[model samples]
Target: MKTDVLIAGAGPVGLTMASELSRYGLSVRLVDKNTQRTDKSKAIVLWARTLELINRMSPNCADRFIETGLKTESVNILSGSEHIGHADMKEVDSKYKFVVMIPQSDTERLLEEHLATFNIKAERQTELTDFKETSDGVTYVLKHADGSEETAEASWLIGADGAHSIVRHKLNKEFHGSTLLSDWMLADIYLTGVQGTPAINIYWHADGILALFPLQGTRHRIIANVGESSGPIGEGNRPAPTVEDIQRVLDTRGPGGIKAEDSVWRSNFSINERKVDDYRSGRVFVAGDAAHVHSPAGGQGMNTGMQDAFNLTWKLALVSRGICQPEPLLSSYSAERSPVAKVLLEFTGRATEAALLRGGVKQSIRNHVASLVLGFAPVTHTMANLLSEISIGYSDSPLNAHTQHPRHGVKPGKRALIRENEPPVGFGDAPRFALFAESNNLPSALLLKYSALLEATPRAPLSPDSLSLVRPDGYVALATKSGDWNAVDAYLNQFLPKAS
Candidate 1:
């Protein structure tokens, strides 16, 4: 078999990788060892940024997701009977302000549906047993359930497999991080008497953290820290919690009058904060849990991985089409994403530590500080933006360039807004950079020179005296003054294919 890209794992992250590649007109083969998609609701929140990327791929598909998933607008934090703080997601600077509460199972289902529009289907029960890389491409073998082995070749291999990724192990990358000592329990159950509007309810009791994420209908996902681990982390010798255990934790930690029953899924697991040194090694690369794993405190585990797929797919598509040089385009993937994973790890670790604080005096101080800090509008708005992930940018990215003079509105390496009536940067079969400038002419000769890699017509600038080059993923690549064609040319030349 032959393909442009071979993706391992059929989970949400892998599905995202495959879907984006397919949408970009790349030939992708998605495979997984599991016979069926996940039925369990593991990772459940779709942040604003993730939804924005999905909409960039297909607006109608995103509409379906919104219709099926519940929209949560705020998060309420409490300490026993005392209310600590509330984060209003309405302040997020995007058209879609609320977090979409959809199950991972639902996410996979929808992504698979989207991929079908491109006539691509995941080959289930097919596992990547081994692989090797050559001078220009990669050779891989897939083992079917019947024990038959099929050999294939591809230009690139993506490892979006889960934490115990066979591809990561084969690449000899060390998943460097520590296993958190506390044991956590997650329960997806039907509940009654949920207080307030549909919002995330967090209780920082003296015992530990109890978080309630609202799901579709009466369903809710309850996750809590069950104190120190008595046994080893991996084997999970600890038994699954019952409805009574869930009730006990809620009664002790959450506000009164809520009841949980009719359990759907319940399991105990330990948190691990680990990531590889790089996201890519030659023709092979890792995304999702294969690249990083951290605490699920902010529900960013899946969103970050999906965004990883978003970041890599466009560059892969552009390079595969010979529209951009491979070195800087591909190398920037690790440079831009590695730091993001590190920041996420540290942020989640701090949140987990804060929730686990013990002793009366320390707990009181923590509650007081949280209340006072979150009371301010700027504090709440910033926290809301962080949680929604709309504030993520690549200002430090190697791909970003600047002019001598600064411009207003969106800065280079930051996110540039897409007008409500305008198509997104990467809307067509190929990924093309959008040029925003005050001048209407924009030297059509220059655009024609790189038509395959750039949009044909220049878009009206959002601000006067500003010219911006926006990446396919909707981030500003170059922000300069009007008619700074030299700056734009230099930036594109870095990734543009060299002249023959």
Candidate 2:
């Protein structure tokens, strides 16, 4: 069998890749070795930027997530019983201002259901055992649960297969990074006496950091550092924490009066901060845990991976359909997303280290500094934007183009503000850029020449002096003087087929 794209692993990242490709009318086959979806609540918070991107997938697609998941409006930082500072999600610059607290299991299920709407279901119990990539495409072998092997060909291969990805291994890419020696425990259970509204509460205690993330109703997720590890870092190396163990930590570290009961899940794990330098190798690419995995500190691990799929698929769709050139368009995937992972790794690593501050003098100074810094409105606002991922941009991307005109308003490579009641930039079966300028300012000849690369009608411009060409993924591709049609044409020409 043959397809346009062969996606390995049916987790959230792979599901997202398949969904976006299929939405663009591409043939996609998603395969996973697991027989069933996960029941564990794994990576739990879907930030505002992720929800905004999901909205572009289809009408009311994000609404399904908002309805099913719990909405958290703020993150509070505390030093034992005293409140240090807080970052309010209401201040985030997006329509979906609040972070949605949904389980990874539910996220995968919803993504799979969305993929089904495209008439594509994940091939479960089927694993990618081997693959060889030629100059034009990839030919691979899949091993079935019953021991039958099937050979298939695809125009491209995606490894969303996760940390132990066979695809990444086959490409001979080194995942270089170190693992922290400290151990941490995670618990999902019914709890009482968690104070205040449904917010993320982080208590910086002398022992370690204790964070309580509220789920639907009375359920909550608790994570705490439990000192340095004595054994190797892997599952079953440390025993799962009991309810009593959780309660003890909560009593000692939390802001008092929190009772733990009716435990649902409990596990202990070590944090690994590892990533590959490049996300793509020839016709194959790795995403999610396959490419990078960082500290769960800010719950960015899953959202970053999902956004990787979002960024890569639209470019893939355009190239595979012969609408765009393959060079810079495909190469931009790694160039753009690799920096994001690099930044994320550094940010999460710093956060983890800050939380694990041991010495009393260092802890006191860290707490004092954090309290003072977060007390500023601008600091808290920036914190909120970073946590929700609203501030992520590819300013240095090879795809970015700008005119010599003085920069004003949203610059090239920044995300255009997603306004209410307005359809997103990439909302249809075809991946096309949206032009944001007065209809009269648009040259009819320009639209006619690059119809496959641009939207038919121009929306309202950011400013009367400036026009913007936004990518299918909502990033600013070209920002220049309002009447600069020549700049727009030149920008579009770079991606158009050579014959065109």
Candidate 3:
């Protein structure tokens, strides 16, 4: 059998890759070794930037997530019973300002449903056992639950297969990082007598860190650091936290007078901070946990993985359809996303270390500094943007281009703001750049020449002096002075097929 893309795994990241590729009219075969999706409520929050990317996939698709999940408007930091500071989600510049709290299971189900609209369904109980990449495509083998094997060919292959990825292993790429020795407990349960707005609460206690994430209705998720681990880092080896265990932590760490009951899920696991230096190897690519996994401090693990899918698929679609060359266009994927993952790992690692500080003068000093720093509006706003991932940008991306006299507004490689009632960038079947400039300012000749790669009409510019070309994934590709058509032309020329 033949397909345009062969995706391994069916988690949120894999589902996202399949959905984006299929939405772009590519043939996709999604497979997973597991017969069913996860029932556990892993990865509990979807940041604003992720929701904006989902909005581009289809109109009202992000709305489905917003409706089904809980919305958190702010995050409060506390030292035992005393309030330290808080970050307001409203400070984020995106239209979807608040973070949506949805379980990984529901996220997968929703992504699968969206992919089904394009007539693609994930093949369960099927695993990718081996593969060999050729010049033009990848030839792979799949093993079924019934001990049967099938050979297939695809123009490309993606390993969203996770940390234990067979595809990543086959590529001989090392997942470079270490697992922390500390064990943390996670619980999803119903809580009564919990005070405050629908917000994420983090309590810095003398013992460890305890966080409460509000879910739909009366349900909440609790995470706490227990102590040093005596065993390995896998979740299977760690004992599950009982309701009593959760209540004990809450009573000791959380703000006074909160009861934990009706437990739904509980598990203890160690944090692994690992990432691959490159996201791509020849015609194959690894995303999500296959490429990077970090601390859960910022709730960025799943969102980062999903964004990796968002960033790679548009480029893949353009190249696969012969609309662009395979050189710089494909190489830019790793160049763009790898740095973002590196930053995330460092940020999450710092956050985890800060929260795990043992009680002493150092812990007191840390709490004092955090409270003092977070009290500043700018500090809190920056934290909000970082945590929600609205501030992520590829300023150093190879795909970024600019003229000498570029106007000042949104610079090259920054995300253009998604305004209300306006259609997002990259909002169609074909992967094309959206032009942000006055219609009258754009020359018909320039539009005609790159019509295959550019959006038909130019939207209003950020400033009258700026002419911006935003990529299909909504990052700035070219930011030049208004009426500088030469820069735009030169930028698009790089992706054009070379003469033989």
Please report the candidate that would top lDDT against the real structure: 2
Instruction: Supply candidate 1's per-residue lDDT for 403.
Output: 68
TM-score of 2: 0.98
- lDDT per residue (tens digit) for residues 26-142 in model 3: 999999999998898899999999999998999868999998899989999898778888989989888887999998888988998899899888999999999999988999999
For each predicted model, how many residue pairs clash, with residues at least 3 apart or on different chains?
A: 0, 0, 0
Q: Which lDDT values do the candidates have, in the order given?
A: 0.89, 0.91, 0.90
RMSD of 2: 1.1
Model 2 misplaced regions, further than 4 Å: none
Give the C-alpha lDDT of model 3: 0.90
What is the overall TM-score of model 1 with all chains considered together?
Answer: 0.98
lDDT string, candidate 1, 1-500, tens digits = 57999999999989999989998888999999999999999999998888888888786457778888999999888886788998898999888889899998999999999889899999999999999998888999999999999998999999998999999999999999999888999899999988778999899998899999999889999999897877876627478999999999988988878899799999988989999989999999999999999898889999999999999999999998888889798999999999999999999999899989989899899999999999999999999989988889998998888667555557778889868888878887788899988765577768877788888888888688888889999999888888888887787878888887
TM-score for every candidate vs. truth?
0.98, 0.98, 0.98
Per-residue lDDT for 43-127 in model 2, tens only? 9999999999999999979999999899999999888878888999999999887989998889998998999898899999999
Which pairs, if any, clash in model 2? Answer: none
Indicate the residue-level lDDT of 188 in model 2: 97
Error of 3 at 52 (Å): 0.4
Superposition error at 333 for model 1 (Å): 0.4
Itemize residue pairs with steric clashes in candidate 1: none
